[model samples]
Target: MRALTVTVRDASTGPVVEIAGDLDYETAPRLRQAVEGLALEPGTLLVLDLARLELCDSSGITAFIVARNRAIAAQAEVALTAVPAHTARVLRVVGLDQIFNLYPDADSAALPSAVQPPPTANNR
Candidate 1:
């Protein structure tokens, strides 16, 4: 069995997790751990770049869902980018395509600028 490797990189959107190799029962936990470890801020958007992902199974799909939930819990958003055709089909079949924000690339999913108004509780 080929070893699975997930590389993480910081992007303007948020943390970009690049997954490669086979994502199965044995390697899904690592992917979940990597996503959970990131302390994302509210409104931040996490982009999962799956262009390099070679394979995936039910466990792998579950890991992706876990990552999405984690991001939402932190008040951040999560997007799937460059998902392989096979995986995309699986997601569609499972109705996850509607649940996750899908992007063609990382650049397309870049986070928008913050638009919160300045605090005015104690202005002089």
Candidate 2:
């Protein structure tokens, strides 16, 4: 089985966690532990970069939920970036896509400057 590795770094939005490798039964707890250890703040976004995440099972999904709950408890937000197509499909099918904010990449997720401003009446 592929191993799972989670690395956390600070970002403009908040703390960005880059997750690689498999997120299965064996590795889900590791991710949960890592996220539980974070000190999230109000209004900050906890961005999870899943660009290289190999696989995610039920346990992994649970871990994601745990992370979200922890962030919410801290009054922070949560987002998922660079989600693989298969993973996206699973999230969509399970209705999790609606629950989590998704981004094209970590940069787009963490940088508010990259966000598109709402179009004005002139543009509409």
- Model 1 gets an lDDT of 0.81
Clash tally, candidates in order: 0, 0
Error of 1 at 90 (Å): 0.7
Over 4 Å off in model 2, which ranges? 113-124
Give the Å shift of residue 35 in candidate 1: 0.8
Compare the candidates by TM-score and give the number of the best one: 2
Instruction: Residues 1-124, candidate 2: write the lDDT tens digits.
Output: 7888999999877889899999999899999989998989898888889999999998988999999999989999888888898888898889888778788887876667433321210112
**Deviation from native of the Cα of residue 24 in model 1, angstroms:** 0.4
Give the 10-residue window scoring lowest on summed lDDT in candidate 1: 115-124
Looking at model 2, report the run of 10 residues with the lowest lDDT sum: 115-124
User: Model 1, residue 36: what's the lDDT?
Assistant: 81
